[model samples]
Target: MSVAIPIFKPVSQMQLTPGSTVTIPDVTWEEFESILQELGEKRASRIAYNQGNLEIMVPLPEHEISKDLISDIVKILLKAKGIKYQPFGSTTFKKQGTAGVEADACFYIQNYQQMIGKRRLQPDDPPPDLAIETDVTSKTTLGAYEAIGVPELWIFDSGKLAIYLLKDGKYIKSEQSPYFEDIAITQIIPDTVERSWQVGSFQALEEFANLYLSIIE
Candidate 1:
């Protein structure tokens, strides 16, 4: 699954026609590689002290679910369908242009590996087909994925989910999957946002998936 990244990229690529509005910094691929290496080393150190739990850095939020009930409920339902899932993992690409980005939760019908210039994420590497993000950080991080070419992006912020699918070199709102074809937010996200008036509306999403699944099957 390929997607657009929000970074400044060279207009030299024929397909990526230069836009008078956008200007990419002319940094060699070597510079990006070195930056990744340094960041990985420092982040890896902090990750070492923490085990079992996922933490990229001490101050940064851990790979956490704001709603554990919703997380567990959704995973259980998806697993029943035999779906493969991974959370917050990096996927790098090949050749001179590449990037390594981690997502909050990603779904894959199948998995792939990461191949960097001097490094690789081996057979055990998991590159997800669909990635979800909790947009607490600057929206700029979203562009990083666009630049690196992630196919699907689901951003949840302030209790709303904004989804995008890469189409024709840009990310646009999409309700359906181009890769899975049948998969959509409703299939991946629990419909808890619709039922149980006992809980506030914002909190209802936790019940949507579980309730919908029970009704369907």
Candidate 2:
């Protein structure tokens, strides 16, 4: 006699509220990929898969605002330094059967030349130089990023920014970003983001740009 196995519902059939997260256990890599296809590219939810656990999170408005503000700050600094960068916002990055994650924001700076005109990540391609996450909805799954070997990760949570650098196959908390080693990014980023919430994004950026220029000069 054959027993019936339960089939997982399609991701489209699910309803996830903002600032909520859902975890599905024992999901195979094949199933994970299938779910990604179902979710499509235009969705607001973010996903992370590790080993056999899949986590999906719906970000809040505050989360989106903070991430956009932070990413803008990064771009401003990059432009001021005359650094070339490619921003891939919330792109899904996978490491075959091991792990996969969609970062809140990611950038290719050191390897920007290699990523030119690339649609999908090739197996030999290096991961993004920087990945950003806002933990307003749920905590980011660092294991997925570690498995994929992302060199740097920044997490904004509780009105503060935390930088993690990948070293020797593990993530180590760092005081500053290697890309912006000369600048006090930890303090500047948090302050700028907070000011944006209070005054406005445009005014905050203008003020921060002036301050950054003074510091660099």
What are the Cα lDDT values of the candidates? 0.45, 0.89
Error of 1 at 11 (Å): 28
> Could you tell me the lDDT of residue 118 within candidate 1?
22
lDDT of 2 at 68: 94
65 in model 1: Cα distance from truth in Å?
Answer: 3.0
Model 1, span 1-217: residue lDDT tens: 9998788433232132221122224434565454445455423212110011111322223224433333454465566565655433333332224333455455554542232232544434434556665533433345555655667776665555667887675688876655434445544443343232347434565455444556435
Candidate 1 residue runs with Cα over 4 Å from true position? 1-28, 41-63, 67-74, 85-95, 112-127, 136-140, 176-210
Stretches > 4 Å off in candidate 2 = 1-8, 136-140
TM agreement with the true structure for every prediction: 0.52, 0.93
Cα lDDT for residue 198, candidate 2: 91
Candidate 2 residue-wise lDDT, 1-217, digit = tens:
9999999667888999998899988989999999999989999899999888899999999999999999999998888788999998888998999899999999999999999999887888888999999983333379899899999999999888999999998899999898888999999989998999899889999999887877765
* Consecutive 10-residue window with the lowest summed lDDT within model 1: 45-54
